[model samples]
Target: MKEIRALAFDVFGTVVDWRASIIREGESLGRRKGLSVNWAAFADAWRAGYQPSMERVRRGEIPWTNLDGLHRALLEELLEKFGIEGLDEAEKDHLNKVWHRLAPWPDVPEGLARLRERYVLATLSNGNVSLLVEMAKRASLPWDLILSAELVRRYKPDPEVYLMAPRLLDLEPQEVMMVAAHPDDLRAAAEVGLATALVRRPLEFGPGRSFRIPESGFDLVAGDFVELAQRLLGREATAGPRRRGAPRPPSPG
Candidate 1:
């Protein structure tokens, strides 16, 4: 992993806690509608539709589309299933945008800010570029570039998406570190010669939400983004003697 330079992160559960933030947003919106809905259940069920929804497109059962497009379709189905009605098109549109408004995991911004000082940080998310860009602005995420599956038209766990980043950044796969909360994503990255870093977010799915990160062939493991930055610095700092206060090396592009 010595040649690793750019650190590309998976955005949803990895950088921001999507499930919990969605629940909070749903609860607030439900309260306004006086709908006494189980917001947590609503959030989970909506997200549960996520994978099957994408597979439809991947299998060519439907047309190719961005995550936001896919999400809006699932959101409409869920609204009807949950008996959530009486919303105007405008309100529904706003609700669809909720994914764009998700707050970061508590440590994310501060940690990324610190890490950005030394590395060229880019988002390598399944989320669409526009969606990721909006989320970055909404949450004040300090991403140097937004590199999404939308650009590659492929999703996580696909070698295309994993390999696209290094090409876009003009580097070898080994010079790019794939940072994700999901072991499956990093596993895909590793299969293609990329370095891997796992940053745990045990509560990413919320307290009772059932997602787990299996131990895997990761190059590094971190408690959170802050720890990730600290460990990277430690690795670089120990690489060799350097002129005092000299700049650290940068990743390609």
Candidate 2:
């Protein structure tokens, strides 16, 4: 591979453990709501609404909408399914925004801090700009830029969002890389000539999160963000045989 430069990341599961965080927080919400529902199962059902809701937009059945709106639609449905009641408009509004306050995995902040030193790190997610900005402030993520499908008015698995990065950065597609915890997302990036790295997030779905990691379309697979950054720095430092005192190449594309 030509030396890696900028790294774009998928924010939801890759950077933050959306499932576990939501389940944990939602469990607390459920208790406060006096709804003794299965929070984990509710999380799964809520997630189940995601693709279908996106499909509605993708298929033109509905206008383009961000994940926040999609999550709200499902949250209201889930509240009824769990028999949660007595929530006023303000309560419901606060509850619908629960997704915005997801906590990162323990490794996230430290790892991202390390990586930010060696790369032009930014989000390339389906999340809205405000949502990501708020989440970064809340979670202390050191993102250089917060990019979203809201900018492109589309989501991941769509070429527009993937391709928008190069245009904004004024770089060719091959010069930028995508770092994610998903093979499918990597495949999509790689298909468009962008470099790819897989940052494994095994705790993303709790203990049952799959340990069997896939190996494909990934220029490198890292255990977390820190490891990925170190590897990138080392790779750039040694991309070519050079004189002992020669300066290392720059990291950003």
Candidate 3:
């Protein structure tokens, strides 16, 4: 409601289906390597390591390392934990870069396009610059820019990470909305005076996993990116009675 000029999104679960993408890629790797493994569990374990790995950095238990480095470290552990073997260095590297090739949620491409008509869209994620860039290119994500925690050498839930968006985009915190599927991420943005929008991603952790929607504490809540665009643009359209030449929100696709 504060006239948002830009939208900064959490890429992993909000825009792209990371779990499914990882599982798909892992299955492919398993086949090529002739390894029998539960890829779903493997994907979950890899993702499970994400926060703890970041926390290690936050606690200064490790020196500054990008998400790629953290993920590669986790991948090595997971390979051994799951009894996987015989992958050459190149194969392992390709599997590690699977994060770069994640498929976007079905609504993302057009939804972001719709939102971009009025708002500058950027990725505000924990992923490294190269990783985010490759993902945007591979998925045709249509981001106006990629702003990562790697730029500031920090991870999400860190105030500096959220603050980076407003600083880099030359906008007030309120003028940039942080769009994420996770409440903690949005809450952190809100604490830093940025507007927040929660886009529910019930399947982010995969099917049958219980996801609780917050009852309040966000500027907006949407089921997906398309709905987010509709809500934001719709509000703008009706803000003060449309002028004769004013643009209307795109009809639902």
Candidate 2 local lDDT, residue 250: 50
- The parts of candidate 3 lying over 4 Å away from their true place are 240-253
Off by over 4 Å in 2: 209-213, 240-253
- Ranking of candidates on lDDT, top first: 3, 1, 2
Candidate 2, RMSD to the unseen true structure = 3.7
Question: What's the lDDT for residue 34 in model 1?
Answer: 82
Which pairs clash inside model 3?
none
lDDT by residue for model 2 over 58-158, one digit each (tens)? 88998988888888888889889978778898987776776778788777787778777767888999888888998889888888888898998887799
* Total colliding residue pairs, candidate 1: 0
Best by TM-score: 3
Worst 10 residues of 2 by lDDT: 244-253
Clashes of each: 0, 0, 0
